[model samples]
Target: MITLDARKEKVGDLLRVSFQTQIKFFLSNTKTKAAKSVIYNYIDIFTKDVEIINLMKEYEAQTNKKLAITLPSEEVPSRDAWVNSSIIFDSRT
Candidate 1:
């Protein structure tokens, strides 16, 4: 059987975007019905910066998910720290 490299899996950006979008949707819909909205859970996020880790905690509190954001020893800060640092994201984009 041919084996693919697991290290090549770079889906952090995708997961982060999905998580932010879903949480935003749930919060915005509070005026109407939020129970129907999906609260993402069991998400595993890997990062290095402590700031991002804290931010993820806030997101977790809002979504109440079993999300896990790990900080690998070899991980480095994201290139676009300014934008990626913020948890508030526009769902339109």
Candidate 2:
């Protein structure tokens, strides 16, 4: 359920875009003091997982570009890092 609004690209007719997708914190740890504010009001931080696509096409032709980005973990939060890398082990049911 991700929606990207591309209304900011007024660059070349050969379209270009830069985007960094983010995961917002809503309904946070309601049982913990640490996330009180995040639970009360919607909270958000940025992440680079958001995929951006750019295409350059003549009005009736197909065109494309490779959209590769870097998501260095040191630059993102580690709070829930385990959720993304718990695939290597078949232990602990």
Candidate 3:
């Protein structure tokens, strides 16, 4: 039987690989700017989630490698925008 920590580690690795693959597929196959924008927004939301951030951090620490999702330069949001948006939503609840 697999231990709990080992399972978690495996899941993390899968998550990272799956995310990378999805991004590559979308970038290559997506044809319209509007559709790509929507997809990028969803990706931003997923990557910015607190739980996902923590998981990525833990994975990086374990593997000694960086796992980052890069978007097109034009589609990338500023750091301040991310922080402010999170604060706005966090304050609402």
Candidate 4:
């Protein structure tokens, strides 16, 4: 049987790989400079979220126990960020 920790680790790895692939695809295929800029900013924000990183580490440390993750109450990238991203995405299609 696969252990819970192993399963979690695999899922995390899969998500990271998936995001990386998507980012690469967008960067390569996105024609406009503005769209690429938005994607780059999103990547920067994601990588700099220390709270999320800490939460992940905590969860990894307590894999065997049932732990409730209380995400940071404050939104990371605010609604404005999504609006910009959405506009960029929409422009591509």
Candidate-wise lDDT, in order: 0.42, 0.24, 0.48, 0.43
Q: After TM-score superposition, what is the CA distance of residue 73 in candidate 1 from its true location, in Å?
A: 15
Model 4, C-alpha of 10: deviation from truth (Å): 1.7
Predicted structure 3: lDDT = 0.48
TM-scores for all predictions = 0.31, 0.18, 0.33, 0.33
Mark the regions of model 4 whose C-alpha exceeds 4 Å error after superposition.
1-3, 31-93
Off by over 4 Å in 3: 31-93
Better of 1 and 3 by lDDT: 3
lDDT, residue 50, candidate 4:
44
For residues 1-93, write the lDDT of model 4, one tens digit per residue. 887455654654454455445545543564334333433444443432444344334334444433333436574554233334553347677
Worst 10 residues of 1 by lDDT: 35-44
Among residues 3 or more apart in sequence or in different chains, the pairs in candidate 4 whose N, CA or C atoms overlap within 3 Å are none
Q: How close to the true structure is residue 29 of candidate 4, measured as C-alpha lDDT?
A: 65
The candidate with the higher TM-score, 2 or 3, is 3
> Which of candidates 3 and 4 is the stronger one according to lDDT?
3
Best by TM-score: 3
